[model samples]
Target: MTDPDRPVAIPAVPRPKDRPGRAPAPETTSTYRLGQGPLRLPLWLRAVILACCLVEGLLLAAPLLGLGSARAVSLMLGGFWSPLLGGGTGLYPGQGAVMFLTYGLLHAGLLHLAMNMISLAAVGRELTRMIGAGRMALIYLASQIGAGAVFALMQPQAGPMVGASGAVFGLAAALVGHAAITLRRRRRSMAPLVRAVALILGLNVALTLLMPSIAWEAHLGGALTGLALGLIFAILPRRA
Candidate 1:
C-alpha cells in the first residue's frame, strides 16, 4: 500500500449554477391593446340606449318645449307630480319605479349624454347578444340601481346622479371577466391583462380622488357587480 500524504486533498465543493433565464420582456401598457374591441354595438343594446336617451331628452326638454318653464327641471329628473297636479305622492303607480330607470336616461349636460351613448353604441350590443337580451337588460338595470344606491346613500346632497356610467363600467368589468377566462382556458397567464387593468383602475382611482367631477363610486360598485354577474353568466347554462 502507498503511504498516505500528511493531509489528504479535500474534494472541491461545487457552487450552484444560476437559475434558467426567463424570456426577455419589453415595457408596455396593456390598455392600449385591450381598451377596445371589434367596433359595433349589438342591436338590442343600440335600440335600448338610443330609445332611452331620446325619451329622456324629450322629457327633460318637455317643460321648456311645451309648458314654457325655464325651471321645469322636475320632469327631467322624473319626480312625483304634486296632488295639486292631479297625482298622489306626485307619482303614478309606476312613476316611482320610473324614477330609478329615468335617471340613466337623463344627463346633466350634452357632453354627459354623448359619452354614455358612445359607450353603449360600442359594447352594450355585444353584451345583449352574448348574454342574451334578457340577461343583458337585467345587468343594465341592476348595475344602474346598484350604482344609484351608492350615490343615493353617499352623495344624496350632490344633486341627482345621472348618466350611464354605472352600466358602462359594468360592461367593462364583464369584459374583464370574460377575457380573464379566455386567457386561462388557453393556459395563458394574465399578467399582461392584469397589469393593464391595474393601470386603468389606478388611473380611475387617482382621478376619483383628485377630481370632484367623476362618479367613481358607481364605477366601483358597477364593476364589482358586473364581474360577479359575468362569472355567474359564464357558468350558467344557456336557455334554448
Candidate 2:
C-alpha cells in the first residue's frame, strides 16, 4: 500500500499501434502537414493584381458614373503613344516617360484584363519565389521599358498601345530562359527548350494573323529583355 502522503507512481501506458486493415495517422512535422494549403502569393504580386483590377473597375464604372468615356481619357493620359517619344505634347507632364509603365495598368476590356491578370499571377508567383519580389519587379519594369522602346521605334505611327501583354511576355521569357540555363547546367538536351520556343513563336504568329491589332512588337521586346535578364540572373553568384 502507498503511504497517504507519498506521490503515487503511475504505470506507463503503451502506445497505440495501427489497427488491422487501417493505416496509421501521418506524423505532423514542422516543415509541412498532411492537409496544409499552398503558400500565399507575395505582396507585390497581389498589389499589381489589385491595381489592375481597380483601374479596369474605374474604367467600367466611368460610363455609369456619368464621367463620359473614361477609357479614352485613360488611354490618352496613360497609353504609350510613339509620337510622344518624338516630342509630342502630352496631356500631363512626364507623360512620355510615364506611359511606358503606366500602360500596363490599363486594359482594353474585361477580357483583356482577365487574361493579363491570370498570366501575371501565374508567372509572377513563380518568379517571385525564384528570385524574390524585388528582382521580379525590376524585371517587370525593365520589360515594360523594353516594350515601350521597341513600340516607339517600330510603330511610330501606330495607335496607342495599352495592355500588360508585353510585361507578361517578358515574365514568360524569363521563366523560359531560367529553365534553359538549368537544363544546360545539367547537360540536358536543348530539344525541349527549342520546342517551347517554337511553340511560343507559333502562337505569336497565329495570334498575329488572327488579330492584326495585337502588339507583337512589344511582346518581342519584352521577351528579349526578360531573356537577357534571366540569363544574367542565372549566372550571378548567390550571396552567402
Candidate 1's C-alpha runs over 4 A off are 1-40, 55-76, 79-96, 125-130, 156-158, 206-211
What number of clashing residue pairs does each candidate have, in the order they appear? 3, 0
lDDT of 2 by residue, 1-240 (tens): 645555454544455888999987665423323344565677877888899999999889989989877888888888889998887888889988889879999998998899889989988878766666777788888998998889878998765898988888888898788878988899999998899889888988998898898999999999999999888887875454
User: In candidate 1, what are the lDDT values of residues 1-240, reduced to their tens digit?
Assistant: 523433334444454554579553433432233234564655567776777677657656767767555324644346212221223342355654566676666565566677778776666756655676677767777877777666655655454456688877777677677667767878999998799689769977886787677787777777777877877786777789
| Position 171, candidate 1: lDDT | 77
* Model 2 steric clash pairs: none
Runs with alpha carbons beyond 4 Å of true place in candidate 2: 1-37
Highest-TM-score candidate: 2
Error of 1 at 159 (Å): 3.2
